[model samples]
Target: MRIALCALLLTGLLVFPGVLPNSPGHLGSLAETALPWFGLGVPLLLVWAAVRRSVKEVTCVLVPAVAWVALFWPGIVDFGGRDLGRADFRVLTVNVGGDRTAPRDVARRVRATDADVVALEKVPGPAMHAYEKELGGRYPHHAVGDTLGLWSRYPLRGVEKLDLGGAWPHAVRAVARTPVGDTAVYAVRLPSVRVGLGKGFTVQERDASAARLARRVADDGTPRVVLLGDLNGSLRDRGLAPLARELRSAHRQAGEGLGFTWPAAFPLVRLDHVLVRGLDATGSTVLPDLGSDHRPVVTGLRAAR
Candidate 1:
């Protein structure tokens, strides 16, 4: 009986990670998403069995309880993010919809944060100057490309455009020198995935962008780096494998709740993200919408030991 109970726990532990990828139907992704929730039901059942003097059943419960602990403990315990000794500068990233007419208002809000550095995605041509004008004084150091831009309270260097596989100007990579240290920031917006096209989510575009991001970060060798934007897919989805392997989501580590940021009216999935590598994210959260479909993700990062 002990042997059987131990085996059951081991099997559940091994199977849990694969459930979503191998859903019951080959399996499907939905099952993967739902399996963990089903896991909660077992604990309740175990309690009832215990009260009934079902010694054998109670012992069996240990299998899943232990397995789940072994699988998820690292995420739970290692959350403080490497904890580099130096204090981190505050960084803010926003999608800043390309169509927004008043760059001043957007700039006003961005400037209000007074973050050490700011990274922007989906910047439209018309709003560029307003952003420039509004943030001009505070963020003296600046870098601008066709679409994406970076503004910093400190000096900026190594400004360049990143190719996200579609057209030009979807992403940019830059270096900012803060009083604390120098760090790399990537402002990226993956291609939009439309459910109606029969093509499903634009995984191709996201994959290509991930590939580029992986290479850039690999070569950057900066002590700290951040990738910010609307990835359009949840962490559970495999499309973000490349980026996921190298970075940690600030939301997963310090944000309140799930930190959902999409479909602002009623967020379901956390599409937009702030991923960190070679740094410790001390805090993360989702801010109220500034009129865009996606809400903003605010993350505070420090250097990693």
Candidate 2:
């Protein structure tokens, strides 16, 4: 009976996480954000069944194990195929946090990626000058709006601030003229979410901001678009479903492993993403830490002609 109950609990969390209540605490959203980690319970259950010497319990354990594999196996495997030729462009995005020291070092590390485009968020106003100075030589074209910034090796045009229902601008949009063609790029930093003993999961502001951002992206006329930012929530979180439906996550398409990028010292969840549309993602990876709370994500893309 203990094994049966354990199996049911694991399966329910894996397959029906959405059914969990969101009020008081946003349990459902939290489950979805940490969904992949829940697979760890499968082995524990299997061990318990083995000790009990019950074949029935062992079979029950297989139920959740299968469900976990079916849901996340694709993300774990690298099925991006062999040698998709050279990537037309590479993009990198990172939330540099509010660190006052070593901003230059951070800029140097990011520059070493050799990405055609770079997006940075949570950059304090004063540190902007430092980044501009360090990145200016490599990326001649750039734009900065509030804490969000975009730097490109290609010429950038139509630079503008995006209002995602925030008091200050936290998003920016620009067009980059690359050899392949023009592509619209967005640099965004959605509102942060908090979970406290008293408040539970506080994501109301982030959810509203995500909705506004989704609407703006939908209205955009550009056929090719690349969104780079710290979304503050993973793709599995319902708050991001609107944008998730509109864009394809580069990591999911080409990356191996879970690609967690937050709390850089001991990464636990993926808060940064490189999402695209009208482009083929050839490769995606999380870069080494650069003195920030969040790590950087890089993706290789080719125009989907």
Candidate 3:
């Protein structure tokens, strides 16, 4: 019985990858929504093995234990990033949770970052004025469409709304004339997904929205592109695979630690991202929670010379 139990635990550990939340199917949503929690199983299994004190059983458990660490240790530890010198631009992305977060406070926190560009999502209609007034001096150039907005210190041009197969446009594109060159920036907010007993993490809409966003990104002619937004899904989720293939996630490339940014009180998953192409992210990180459900993500990107 001891050996049999150890074998069962080992099988689960080895096969965990098969259950990773990387696809658009229903099963994938459950896995994606709770991807981080999967690591806890390793500790639980370890405790069980120690309690049994069977030499053979404990030895067998080591296989799955090593596998778990191999898969998740990188995220758990802050491997740090290379010193790429000064960055040309600093960008901040945040979902201010509509009325749940105060616009003045949000603007104040953003100002503190001294970001070159700020992308905001879930801006309620009434709070627009407050944000505009609060962010005016710092960011001279601004664009707003539906729930998405972009505030930039640099000159913004050709601002256009993007239709991501939603009721209203939830994304906007603009060109920022920076010291390095003209860089295309996108402020987007993909449809939210649910993780519950009903639909079991419904992501059909999010998947479609991601697909549309991916096509738009691919068609963009800009040599340098930066996408800032509340992606509503983690990088591990396969629905965003198209975008992932086209761009590099700053958090994965240069961030410290896991960089999770949702449920700000205690972020367990990363639903926000800064994805870039043709630019190098010198660093990426999640800022301290600013009274919103989603914590902001800040990244420094250097335009290619």
Clashing pairs in 2: none
TM-score of each: 0.74, 0.95, 0.90
lDDT assessment of candidate 2: 0.88
Q: Is candidate 1 or candidate 2 better by TM-score?
A: 2
Worst 10 residues of 2 by lDDT: 77-86
How far off is residue 72 in model 2, in Å? 2.1
lDDT of each: 0.68, 0.88, 0.83
Ranking, TM-score, top scorer first: 2, 3, 1
Task: Name the regions of candidate 2 deviating beyond 4 angstroms.
Answer: 79-85
Please report the candidate that would top lDDT against the real structure. 2
Identify the runs in model 3 with alpha carbons over 4 angstroms from their true place: 1-25, 79-85
**Against the correct fold, how does model 1 do in TM-score?**
0.74
Clashing pairs for model 1 are 20-32, 22-27, 23-27
Instruction: State the weakest 10-residue window (summed lDDT) of model 1.
Output: 23-32
lDDT of each residue in 1-305, candidate 2, tens digit only:
98999899999999988888877588778888988899999999999999999999999999999999998897678765612236898899989888733778887888788899999999898889988999999999999998889999999999999887868886899999976688999999999999899888888888898888888888888888999999998899987888998888988877757899988988899999988989888888888888889999988899875
